[model samples]
Target: MFRLLVMRGFALLLLAAPAAGAVEEALPNESAAHLSTLGRKPDWSELDKYQATITHDEFVQLFRQIYATRGCNPDLIKVELDVARILTAAETQNYFVLHFAKGEADRRPVPRWWAVPGALPNEARTAGPLAGFHIALDPGHLGGTWAQMEERWFRIGDAPPVEEGNMTLQVARLLKPRLQSLGAKVSLVREKAEPVTPYRPSDFEEIARQLLLRTGVKDARENFDGPADPEKEQTIAWQRELLFYRNSEIRRRASVINHRLQPDLVLCLHFNAEPWGDPHHP
Candidate 1:
């Protein structure tokens, strides 16, 4: 009788093994052929129609449903607002892309849901209220040597001075970890105290000329026959450079936020300063 009972237990274990294996199976990796469809160009007309009818929340819900239907782990996909309103044709094809890990284990060209780090089971979101939110922090202005040119730096007396760019970067760094701890995905538009765009002042020399002339820095009367003195020429050039850098940096940051990160919310940090009432007093 004991031998018969042991045989019965072994049979039961064999029967349960397939169920356990199915539960433990990783999400299937997409094939290159399957991924090709994801890269298809968007029909702008269709996208416009969808944009008219589909609210942001509805799009997110639709994405989640599609993700599940594709046999992908829902945690591997993230949906953001695309608030910059600069979605490229490729990005417009899908609400979100599957994020994967790097290295030998994930040699597949296409992303695998199991490769995504910190991709908890769909049921694990109960731990944090913001489990699936994406947030972006944009620190305003170019700091470092460009701070003075950006007009975001001011020194009073022997004080260390205040730089808006540096201050915003610090704030973003502090806020990133806190948001991540709360289970929110966070990204910084400008990670450091530098310009995001590769454009330089010299690139927009013509625009700079118009700006300087308009601003009276290059007066027609004073420099009718070109700059009269080296000082006047230097002043015009500096103003032109500043204008180019300022506008280019802003445009680049917007591109990064809209095309690349596409976070649900954008927090632009800036520090405003008023002219000192008495420079010597405080």
Candidate 2:
């Protein structure tokens, strides 16, 4: 069924750079800093490579049609005449600006590590359409023991539980060889159901406490391992586990794909299902 589904290829841009003086205001103290569960500060200078690669119209189109629609608030991104200002840190004035190309003639050649189809040699083109392509297959989640925790496991009556992570891995395993057969270099983000992140839930405990405090949870405290308040302790534990499986794990996978593999294309496999209230029932 998945084989019959057509997957459209798209560019995934990761641009960053320090905000200009106009957008960079006084930052809050460390304790009052705002960040994602386990996210770090962005290095905006990375956007330098993408400078003048897209026209103002093109940038606005992609921003509105793609990025903005992806759960991003309109107020977070301001499209200007020559640049798009994106808010990097919420509750702060920190912003990242992406300068737009004047026009098609003014656009510079995009700096990219992957070889484009038009750039491939005649010999490679004759081999296959994907002859010089480097593709990475990313299985969606960590299955096995983490399937239930990630809520990707479901069962109907006495049927075996449907594990999305392992299933996606199986598809990737089957697809890798097929892509290689087309003369493409292929890499898997993960081969098994284990996590790629070295840090576990315990490692994120401190970070979780900080995140809770930012949310105005007054009970949050540092070096808090005692069970003085079980309810609050449970909330902290839950937050830690969520950060481990959701934030840390995906970030590690992205690092492997962007830095290690540097693939031209990435196929992230997953099964999208409607919310079924109880796993046992559906």
Candidate 3:
């Protein structure tokens, strides 16, 4: 009998969800090929050495470097790194200690289960929750970023993460790693570097103002909707060019997003408002 390992300060739950006849679905077969990138779990002795040699921060950092270096993944690395921060290394030590030594504990006392630390085999979720996964996503468009003014996303209404820049940063972060794990090669448009990226706050403001002026919405209300006032015409012309230009810049970054953070699907958000008042933000 393969005795199950119980966690410390954690209890692993299991259930054999059955079909209408109360019979379970056939277990999903886990092939080594599907998990080849994951490498192998540590032996208890290796865990001991890992415990003895690695500090909490060091443990996390080492794994981060491992993920980045081995081409394992970034997001999973980040999640694991977060897990390291969630509890002291001491907790990790205790958990593993109970795991290897106390196999005598009742083997989970439940139905079919997955071992923790080990994610559910890709095969397990392959059909049930994994089949035709639907995702709702957004991205940094028209040069949004965490540090810049909020007005851009405000007008659009479908806000991005904080700022367009940082949102892009995070989006790229999630996108590249996840797809790469599943055997993908992604190319991002705007990295955290110069040119083809969102502008700084001052620059974004100037750009926005320039764009607003070009729109002729700045023209007096008396000038509203005519055979097109010449000044307003100039504004409209500039607005069209500027909006397209800004969007081009965004797509330049998006082009990076397209290549590097490529997903099987893309969702873009466009919103229209009353064109009055400041938009909501936290």
Among these predictions, the greatest lDDT belongs to 2
Q: Give the range where candidate 3 is weakest over 10 consecutive residues by summed lDDT.
A: 1-10
In terms of lDDT, the poorest run of 10 residues in model 1 is 30-39
Selected candidate, larger TM-score, 1 vs 2: 2
TM-score of each: 0.50, 0.73, 0.26
Ten-residue region with minimum lDDT total, candidate 2: 1-10
Reference-based TM-score, model 1: 0.50
lDDT of 1 by residue, 25-121 (tens): 1211221121121122222232221222334554455444542333333232334453213222232534423222233343333211111335555
Which candidate would rank higher by TM-score, 2 or 3? 2
Residue 232's lDDT in candidate 3: 45
Residues 1-282, candidate 2, lDDT per residue (tens digit)? 111110000113551112222322222223334343344454557666778899999876765576443434455667788987766665788777888999999999877666666788888767777898999999998899988767678777787888999899999999999998888999999989999888678877677777777777867544434334455444777677777788778867766776667787889999952238775786
- Can you write out model 3's per-residue Cα lDDT over 110-153, one digit (the tens) per residue? 22112332444566554444323322234444343323222333
Error of 3 at 67 (Å): 44
The runs of at least 3 residues in candidate 2 whose Cα sits more than 4 Å from the true structure, single-residue gaps closed, are 1-12, 15-34, 69-80, 83-98, 220-234, 272-282
Model 1 lDDT, residue 153, Cα: 77
* Top-TM-score candidate index: 2
What is each predicted model's overall lDDT from 0 to 1?
A: 0.51, 0.69, 0.34
Order by lDDT, highest first? 2, 1, 3
